[model samples]
Target: MAAVTEPLLRTERMALRQVTRSDVDRLVLLNNDDGVMRYLDWRPPTREQVVAEVEILLKAYEVYPRHGQLIAELADSTFVGWFSLAVGADGPAAPELGYRLRTAHWGAGLATEGSQAMINYAFAELEAERVVAETMFVNAGSRRVMEKCGMRHIETFHVEFDNPLPGTELGEVRYQITREEWLVARTSR
Candidate 1:
């Protein structure tokens, strides 16, 4: 396996790069906006919280680059959001994929573009056996992105949350696509 380092990934309209401390203000704005965070854990984070989060993300890069993280940016270099492919906390090697985007960037197919790129990297470069995604059932947009990435519905599971978001009562849906499935789909295409 190759050492994971901050990798610069290009998509149709975005670039995925390492998140930096300088991104605090943009991250704060993205997190604070209720529309953008409707499916997330908390409301927008404080500037301090954003700073702390950046530190944690950066540290993770040092410890695990390939499974680390990436910040999605526009061609002009505006921060759109972030994406990650990391091992689940549970005792499994299956990589969990996730993304967050600015509300303004929604409905533009950017998520699908960025996600597909990550999916390709995971399967072809990382040689991952499978990739998985989860979203609150009501988050139709996110579900669509996962489906578009070729991940099919796997299961729905409920996990208790202290201060659950508006859609938590709906439970979460899991979606997955194995490398074999992906290859078969690609060959058929």
Candidate 2:
């Protein structure tokens, strides 16, 4: 991992910053909302559970400088949602991208904007080897955001979920962009 210069990631209209324990209340609402958790395997977590999760991630920052979920906010400082960057899934060691937004912010393109920023940081700042993201096959919206970030579909695989959402039967799609590919993308732009 490399040192992060900017504490908050800025896009044209949003800011991506470290999530604080103070964000737990609103985060609970966001995490527990049925609509927000629709594509996930787990249901809404308790307030205490969310707080503990936040604390764990906060502690992780001490070792890995640029790894964690970033809380997204509007330029005006209104909380929107969170975007996550982590290492590997079950197999290879790669940066895994994930996010969840308030229903009110859906379809606003903030997902794509923030995702691109993170991808740029992964390759440009963290000196990452690869960045990957996965979403349910039916999650057209999430898939589109990954596509916009220059990630290509790498696979579609099945995973048994106890509380599988609609379209989980269609399997999950993994998307990725490698460092070499990212550099080519940048030079072509």
Candidate 3:
């Protein structure tokens, strides 16, 4: 798969674009929300951390556009969340789909919308053979998003974490969908 030069994609009700330094404040707030971080590994990130993360994402665009980060924005320009399609540490051929959304946006289906966009981009533009996503077992919301985006549960795996958050004891679930599966599903629909 080749890198994606374009930094933004539009959805029905949102825009997915590369993160910018200007997004720091909103991102910090989103990351800091305790409700939003419940399934995450750490507490809300500090302002400096947010800035550093945004810079890292920007740099990733240059070196790895095929597997980079994107910010989700509402039609009216509100920063809703961010998503990514990146190669997993385990291998280069497999890309992982991940997303984080503001707590207030939960249950509205924005996660599914944004995720489907990335999944489509992976299969259509990047020619990805497959895409996968993982979430803490207790994070039902995220699990639902993955299901809604047409991914099926592949497995539940346990991994040790130094400072595991609540529900980590339940392990984690991995979901996956292949390009062939996506194509067949779309044709059926």
Candidate 4:
């Protein structure tokens, strides 16, 4: 695995490290699992598809500043999932936060732990003015994770998905927190 330069985000249970080529095998396992992608549009990815996906992500990191996802790993170096702060289609400046983990790790607060670390990195390291997350309305687990990370629901909007999932008709909800809000929340604690 390629070492992340300088600083890294460490939670009580995991370290947020860059997703490198060395993680492709685990990536394939995670992405191909139905439990993980059930709420998303995409289905199981072939080995080749996973390879291409990794290539695309790596290239995006190379071409853009602070534009990549981190591979969440436990102290023992087991892959938990990937959490991202990538540029969103909302605009050139919009960076979206999201995560996808193996079902085995669900309901364990690992998602919130990794997410809070990235939220801090977004405001303190990347100097982002705001951070946002969106998910299908039926994804209560995801919605809770965002809320735990201090993001509040802003709106629910419908998106046309070529391969819609079960909750597609219910639309998607957006949640956000501005840097100002995050800082205040932090200090007030």
Off by over 4 Å in 1: 1-7, 90-93
Evaluate model 1: give its TM-score: 0.89
lDDT of 1 by residue, 95-136 (tens): 788898888888989899989998888888777889899999
Candidate 2 regions off by >4 Å? Answer: 1-6, 89-93
> Model 4 off-target regions past 4 Å?
1-7, 90-93
Cα lDDT tens digits, model 4, 7-72, are 267889988766678778888888876688878756778788878988888898786646578888
Question: What is the model-wide C-alpha lDDT for candidate 1?
Answer: 0.81
Q: Between which residue pairs do clashes occur in model 4?
A: none
Better of 2 and 3 by lDDT: 3
Quote the positional error of residue 93 for candidate 4 in Å: 4.8
lDDT by residue for model 2 (1-189), tens = 112234457888887888777888878988876589877756788899898998988887776757778988886677789888876553223789888999888888888888999898888877788999989999899999999999999999999877778898999999999999999999998
Estimate candidate 4's alpha-carbon lDDT, on a 0 to 1 scale: 0.84
The C-alpha lDDT values of all candidates are: 0.81, 0.83, 0.84, 0.84
